[model samples]
Target: MTTINYISAVTQALEEEMERDEGVFVLGEDVGARGGVFRATEGLYERFGEERVLDTPLAESAIAGVGIGAAMYGMRPVAEMQFADFIFPAVNQIVSEAAKIRYRSNNDWEVPLTIRAPYGGGIHGALYHSQSVEAMFSSIPGLKVVIPSTPYDVKGLLKAAIRDNDPVLFFEHKKAYRLIKGEVPEGDDYTVPIGKADVKREGDDVTVITYGLCVHFALQAAEKLQEEGISTHILDLRTIYPMDRTGVVEAARRTGKVLLVTEDTKEGSVLNEAAAAIAEECLFDLDSPIERLAAPDVPAMPYAPPLEKTFMMNEDKVESAIRELAHF
Candidate 1:
């Protein structure tokens, strides 16, 4: 096993997949020489050359449209959106074309396309660069949404998404890019299933379900909660759309207390589905009312450091909420 950060895991996954499959290629603005805005594609341009590692104009719609076209033509294309906020320009291509190709054509055609975007707050990207766009796309049918919390998980899930027969929206938390690290296998190639959830920590007091950066905060909160005898069972809904309902039910049943967490606004958060599933199947099993922790209904993240903190969910806020639920 090799220790690496979340962003490096992305690069590793791309390199391994490209090596394994000649059809796999990457495209985005500045992906050629700048190695991506966050260096997630560092050295890929040099290794893959201009033909495979394409550098496109600053156009999100064009990027998604071209990738979709390639996928439909039997090529595996990995398209990067500079930031999740910028992806709005390509919503039509993503939601209409790439997402509906297989179903609209009666399963004869498949768009094995992977859309990667760096998302979430805490980097002072202000409003444009720090939006949580996953919640918007999670409800779309025929499209798979994947958000990985750890380096190992990200690498495996990315490989799985790249090879899958359907289009996948892979949202990488920009903050977690460098903040989260884990031991990943080096000699072997592996892929994590897209629809499965992972139990990051096991406890009996309360079940905290989340994804992306919230998973890291929940894990950290669990460590501190253990000191107070408030054991926390943390479930990372790695794939929020076709969420692991069975895992949610089982985890909720295990502790009988549930706390749903996300970086998106609470109104239509993806965790809403998890909460509904628990309510529908595990309501009686719950010891307390299902709770959700998320950002306020603010328009977007603010540039001011203090306002950003207020709009973001972190370890301290998560711990306090988990602790309250544990004692309830």
Candidate 2:
């Protein structure tokens, strides 16, 4: 076991996967020579050489396009979008081409591609850089959206994403890269299966459903609520799209209250889907109305620290919401 930060865990996954499979290679602007904007790809270029660690032009569409092409031709390509907000330029290729190729061809071709991006707020990335984009892609079929909160989940799910026979959108919360650290397996064969949710904290009072950096906040809120005799169960939905419906229903059944949290804006957020599932399957199990904690329907993340703090999701907000639901 190794105690590493989220960024190092990501680097370890890339390195181990590249070493395990000759077909796996990484490409993006500054990834090769600059070790990526966040240094998640640090030292990979020197170890893997230029051919495997490619540096492409400042084009998100081209990067995604080439990655899809490479995957279609039997190569496992991990492409990086400098920031999750910038990935919009490549949405055409991602949603239209890579996502539909396998189904459109009737299992004839598979796009074994992993698109990684640093997402969410708390690093002062402002409007242009800080955006929770999981909701945008989670609605698309044939694509897996993964947002891992811990080092262990990040490394394992990333490796699993790379090995999967379909395109996976892996979002690493920018704030969690260095903030979140935990023990990850040292073995090369370890993998956390995709489409499964882990119950971080087992409780009976209320169930908190969340992902990404918000999972950490939910844990913190759970700990605080535990002090007041309110047991909070946290369900970390590691894979967003192929969501763990069973996990969602079970958690809601275990507890009578449900609190859905996400960093994405409230309008058309991923939490909406989770809440809907709970409403449909576990409505009888719920004692109170389902509560959702998320950013307001704002145009973009504010630049001012005060406004951004309000826009961002935090433990205080989560704790307050849980407390309210517990009483209701």
Model 1 lDDT per residue over 1-328, tens place = 9999999999999999999999999999998889999999999999999988999999999999999999999999999999999999999999999999998999899999999999999999999999999988988998999999999999999999999999999999999999888999987899999999999999999999999999989999999989999999999999977789999899999999999999999999898999899999977887999999999998999999999998988999999999999889
What are the models' TM-scores? Answer: 0.99, 0.99
Mark the regions of model 2 whose C-alpha exceeds 4 Å error after superposition. none
- What is the Cα-based TM-score of model 2? 0.99
Local accuracy of candidate 2 as per-residue lDDT tens digits, 1-328: 8799999999999999999999999999899989999999999999999999999998999999999999999999999999999999999999999999999999999999999999999778899899998999988999999999999999999999999999999999999999999998778568899999999999999999999999999999889888999999999999999889999889989887999999989989988888889999987888988888999999889999999999999999999999999888
Q: Which runs in model 1 stand beyond 4 Å of their true positions? A: none
Local accuracy by lDDT, each model = 0.94, 0.94
